[model samples]
Target: MTHVMACIDNSQSSLAVCDYAAWASQRLNAPLTLLHVLDEEKYPAAADLSGNIGLGSREHLLEELATLDAQRARLALEQGQHMLEKARERTVISGAAFPELKQRHGHLVESLSDLQEDIRLLVIGRVGEDNSRNAHSLGSQIEAVVRTIHRPILITATSYKKPEKVMLAFDGSSTAYKTIQMFAASSLCKDLPIHLVTVGADSVSNHEALGKAQSMLLSAGFLVQAEIRQGEVESALHDYQTEHGIDLLVMGAYGHSRIRQFLVGSTTTTMLRTATMPVLLLR
Candidate 1:
């Protein structure tokens, strides 16, 4: 069965990820899976110290190094299992049904890719343990996952807040329309008031596109307030979110517009890196 999958680690955002995942699972009435990936690169089972080992004690040193590597790998695996169990307990406390636990040894994106077929929604932190120290930097895995995973992804902030209002950053692109269609079809966030906002010129075409999207949501029984803001896409959206007190931001993951550029581009914007609310990126 399809499920809401949350990627978690020993970061400040992991707890938030679990909370959001439970919320999504309840909203979508889907199973929840807590996934903890022990990156092989970070916790390798064997390290080649042959080059550095002196010739006299090479064999003994290699044996000791292998033993140490094994111990490290074991410790990592145990830690991941403990994290998964704790996350499951937290999810249950958050009012979600029992969630399945999964621990894998590999890259996060690769694990998500392999499990994408059964994922209804993916909830992850904006930054992982590796990047948690740098508050201003987006997790390196985020861009790769966004570019690779076709499923709807909820990139969460450092903390979890039960969302009351949602904003859709529409751009009138095909991907934006797809985002609208998906939002209208899904039960997730259907009970909340939605702000359908577009940051660009207030032209006839833009309004028409906005109207079309609004109509789609309205037909789906969504309370949508469509508006067009004038300024830079990122800044305008950020200001609108602040002014309106939006709790969650929704947008297409990829398109021809600046939104797509900032998301999967060479450089990620501060908006995503410093967003105070969760971002739901639809493919």
Candidate 2:
């Protein structure tokens, strides 16, 4: 069975992510696993340790600091567990039978790496405390997973709405093709309309790529519409989604290194930061 994993932190955005994952689970006839990683390190208690003055003795201060850190870690774990339970219940209601709920007690990124082989797709909220708040950027944990894991990721934003229209960014790249396969095989595309889009500087390749993708999606039984647009990739996508009322944007993540993407301002980076809709990024 296909495995769809959702990273739940019990945040407002994470509830929407649960909804998306539940939809994917029912569509794929896949088992759902709601995962919560306690990023104990990110929740340092030093910020909350502002009460009485510390004793002059070194051992006393060290013990007090250790206790405070342990308390913070416990709180994070409890919250993470609560989020996982809620997410599991949501998926179960979506006809996902006996969904799995996992709570990891370590680094978020590392836990994801440990489960890479079993995970076909990782679902997450777009903006979290773990990620930077830059309008057009991915958070640190999501960025790390995209860079290291050779799997697909569905990144959702604050708003929660069932997908009505899906936009596919095709460049004829192998990774982009994999993204197309994900949508075609997903429940979101069963009898649903898909906009197969190709952005380029030259009209020839743009038209050819769009045609090829549209044909492929049609063969896979999707209602496909092809388009060739001219502009910077991110802006074109952002603009088209706004104009066409796209519900979900599906595309490939960058194959290049972090430094390389920053140097070139890759489309994945821009879309992650700027796109108004949810994005399903394939690696």
Candidate 3:
């Protein structure tokens, strides 16, 4: 069965990721899996000791290094197991049913991609272990996973709160419409109030687009408050979220040409960095 998978690490956001995953699992009535990956790039099994060793002692030093690397790999495996167990316990306490624990040795994106077929939704921390100290820095793996995985991803904050209100950042693009359709079809946030916001000029076409999107949600039995805000996209959405106390933000990820997104960056990335609440990103 497809499960809600959460990437767990020893970062500050790990707990929040678990909590949010539990919440999503319950809402969708899906199984949960806590995945801990020992990234080869971060935890390699071999190290270069050639520079430090002299000609005569090179073989001995290499043997010692091999032993040390094996020991380090074992330690990393043990730590990952412990983290998965802890995350599973926390999810159970948060009211989710028994969750599965998985540990893999590889790059995070590769591991996730390999298991993408079985993933209904993916939840991960906004910042990873390396970037957890800096609030403004985005996790290194976030964009790579976003670009590679076609599944929906929930990038969580450093903390989790039961979501009270949901805001959909709509831009009248095809991606935005698809986001609305996907959200309406799922049970993830069905009963919460929806704020359908468009950050652009209040032209007739924009109003029509907003109205159309709002109608789609209303037809799906959602309580939607549609509005068109003026100003930059990120700033306008942030202001509305703050004003309305939105607990979760939903939007399409990378809704521009590949070159354009690369050249100018993506609003999705900006929102992930700046938003205090959890963000559900749809491709």
Candidate 4:
């Protein structure tokens, strides 16, 4: 069966990730997979060790470093397993049915991408253990994972709250159209109160596009409210979200260039970074 993959690390947001994942799993009636990756780069306290030792005592120090790396890896492996166990228990308690646990050794993005086909939904936290709370940066691997995986990704906010209302930030791009279609076809957004807010200067095309999207969602049984407004994309969407107390934001990840849309200058990234609620990004 397809699974809702919850990617977690030893971060403040890990619990939130599991909670959201469990909710999705229950919603979709899919299995839950709590995945914790032990990437050396992500866990430098455990990564390979070769460069830092001095030349004169290189060989001996290299041996020591190797031993240390091995020990660190072992500890990390155990820790990751423990984390997965805890997360599994948490998910089960949160109404998930016996989530599968996975402990992996590799880069987070690559590993998840390889398993993307099996993932029906992806759940992750805004920040990770390695990232400082002070910065506005996303978890180091989040952007990369989002770009690589075509499945819907739910990026949790500071905490979890059952979304009372959902907003679709339509931009009238091809990606936006695709996102609306996917959302309409899926039961995930069906029956939910959804607001389709498009940001653009007054134009016939923009109005037509937003109206069409709204119609599609309505056909799928969504209680959709469509509106056209003018402003910068990110700020305008965020403002709408705030004004409406939107609990979830949906949008397309990439741009005109399907393959490179999310690489840069993507409004999806901006919204994901700053959204006060969860972001359900469609690729």
Q: Which candidate has the top score in TM-score? A: 1
TM-score result, candidate 1: 0.96
lDDT values, one for every candidate: 0.89, 0.73, 0.87, 0.79
Query: Candidate 2, residues 1-283: lDDT per residue as tens digits?
Result: 2688888875556777888888777766678888887765666534444544566646667668768787887788787787777777877775666778898877778898899888877888876654434535556566667777777788887667888888887777665666677666666558768887777766776577667778778988888888877766667777888888999987767533221342124234555766678888765
Choose 2 or 3, whichever is better by lDDT. 3
Query: Per-residue lDDT tens digits of candidate 1, residues 142-166?
Result: 9889888999999998988999999
Candidate 3, residues 174-198, lDDT tens digits: the string is: 8778888999999999999999988
lDDT, residue 255, candidate 2: 34
lDDT of 4 by residue, 1-283 (tens): 2888998788888888888888888878889998888986634554455566565767767777777877888899899899999998898899999988887788888888888889999998888778747336677667777768888888887678877788987778887789988888776665679999877778998889888898888878889899976766777777888798888888777655322333354333555666678888887
Off by over 4 Å in 3: 46-57, 256-268
Cα deviation of 171, candidate 2, in Å: 1.5
The alpha-carbon lDDT assigned to residue 135 of candidate 3 equals 63
**Cα RMSD for candidates in order:** 1.5, 4.6, 2.7, 3.1
Better of 1 and 2 by TM-score: 1
| TM-score winner, 1 or 3 | 1
Order of candidate numbers by TM-score, starting with the best: 1, 3, 4, 2
Write down the TM-score for model 4.
0.89
- Model 1 CA lDDT for position 17: 97
For candidate 3, the lDDT comes to: 0.87
